[model samples]
Target: MSLTMAILMLVGMWLSVAAAMLWGVLRIVRRHSHHHRPPLVPAKPQPVRRPRRPAGVH
Candidate 1:
């Protein structure tokens, strides 16, 4: 109920919130710092197959 106690409580709350925000920002920055590399050569293409019709239906 005293003014000093209320002020200290407010300051503590502010510091805790600020610390949490800073931690989250650092985590995000670290996560995105890595560069992902693609494969040097692309995969080989597959050949298409044609369906054969019945001997009498064609």
Candidate 2:
């Protein structure tokens, strides 16, 4: 193979390897992140009420 062809092939192989490693790392990160997340169903918020005024007091 010509020098240029050999150089291109070497670079391409390295790029593919890097891409594969990156994909695996990201996959693991996503999995762990989901494991720590709260449940999908959210709890209902409690209603707040003002205390009743004393009898005859404004």
Candidate 3:
């Protein structure tokens, strides 16, 4: 095939691959953000207190 034909084919292949990737990514993003219901997150635990150390222990 001629150089021009080869270049055109290469460009078309690249564009097709890019479009497929874009479509896949968009579908995944939409599925992730659908928000049919609110997400459930575990409640935070309360911090425990530490005992004080003795003074003048140098």
Candidate 4:
């Protein structure tokens, strides 16, 4: 094979590998992603919890 053909084949192999990796990562990410994203909604506010005084002190 000519040097140019060898180089092109190597480049194509590398690009195909990168594309496959990207496809796998995208699949994983999409599988895990949810329609109901938790961070988008605001959490409920907690009521203030007052400390209780000791019966003897009071």
Off by over 4 Å in 3: 36-58
Score every model by TM-score: 0.58, 0.62, 0.60, 0.60
Off by over 4 Å in 2: 38-58
lDDT of 2 by residue, 23-54 (tens): 99999998889778676775887688899999
- Can you write out model 4's per-residue Cα lDDT over 1-58, one digit (the tens) per residue? 9999999999999999999999999998898886556665558877899999989995
Query: Please, what are the lDDT tens digits per residue for candidate 3 over residues 22-50?
Result: 99999999998887778777699678898
Task: After superposing candidate 1 on the true structure, give the runs of residues whose Cα lies further than 4 Å from its correct spot.
Answer: 36-58
Better of 2 and 4 by lDDT: 2
| Model 4 whole-model lDDT (C-alpha atoms) | 0.91
- Against the true structure, whose TM-score is highest? 2
Question: How many steric overlaps are in each model, in order?
Answer: 0, 0, 0, 0
> Pairing residues by index, what is the TM-score of model 4?
0.60
As for candidate 2, its clashing pairs are: none
